[model samples]
Target: MKKRLLSRLLLTSLSPFLFINTASAAEQAMIVFDASGSMWARVDGREKIVVAKDALKQVVRQWNPETQLGLMAYGHRR
Candidate 1:
């Protein structure tokens, strides 16, 4: 039973990244993105931050403007 529980926990933990292609169906959904130094790195031809914000904005734009949306960024402090 313990082994099964452990496997389930691992599956749940990895499921988020594993199903990145699936869009959320919730009427309201909030996404938390880490905006630490790593996001400043290069991605494709632009910085990761630029890419992330653009991607987020693209998604947010697709949803209803009145739809509940929230964003929080964390950590770049000394």
Candidate 2:
């Protein structure tokens, strides 16, 4: 019985270290968008900007809640 208890104690003490490599950090995603006037052009009866926004929304909904997302816009005149 003493051997079993000692083995359990050792296992418990080392379990964290043994499994440490399996732990993972949450991943982050950045989504960049073009805000140029060209994006406002109509395509297939829908504006390109609208289509891009809809797609981004869908992707954001599908991503894991723990994951972080950042939005950036470029191409607008300075």
Candidate 3:
């Protein structure tokens, strides 16, 4: 039992180091927000466009330097 426990602890501790050398995070991210009037349209008693806009602003402000984003909207024309 002692030997098994030691081996289990050893493997558990070393597993993170093994991944430290082999694993890496991705390099890029992207975010987009729709600006259309329909995006602002209320659905299910909630305003989707308003919610989306606020969420998008928060996320974009917190984005990493390696990220890029594009925004587009439609249907507000006269």
Candidate 4:
């Protein structure tokens, strides 16, 4: 129940970015993801990395294919 609610809230907060004006020129988005050690910590008994991955999946599913998307991950390596 909590996970579903959190997912809905996350998607709602990002709705603006998901729906960009197609009338304008091509849009570009850069997603900066954190893969630090802290992300291994648990939230509500689930790992933060798991939560983040789920959210990213949701965002990508709704993303406009016409728009360019880039990903940059940090803190993955020592």
Candidate number with the higher TM-score (2 or 3): 2
| Collision pairs in model 1 | none
TM-score for each of the candidates: 0.55, 0.62, 0.41, 0.73
Please report, in order, the local distance difference test score of every candidate based on alpha carbons.
0.56, 0.60, 0.47, 0.76
lDDT per residue for candidate 1 within 23-71, as digits (tens), equals 5564444566658998787644567666666555655566676456666
Candidate 4 on 20-78: residue-level lDDT in tens? 44455888776777699998998778887787789889889977897888777899984
Point out the higher-scoring one by lDDT: 1 or 2: 2
Q: In candidate 3, how many Å is residue 42 off? A: 2.3
Ten contiguous residues with the weakest lDDT in model 2: 14-23
Which candidate leads the pack in TM-score?
4
Error of 1 at 19 (Å): 12
> Model 4 has how many clashing residue pairs?
0
Measured with C-alpha atoms, the lDDT of residue 23 in candidate 4 is 54
Lowest lDDT 10-residue stretch of candidate 3 = 14-23
Off by over 4 Å in 2: 1-24
Per-residue alpha-carbon lDDT of model 2 for 1-78, expressed as tens digits? 643444354445433432222234856656666689998987656676776666556566766776666677888876
Query: How much is the lDDT of residue 14 in candidate 4?
Result: 49
Model 3 CA lDDT for position 70: 41
Model 2 scores a TM of 0.62
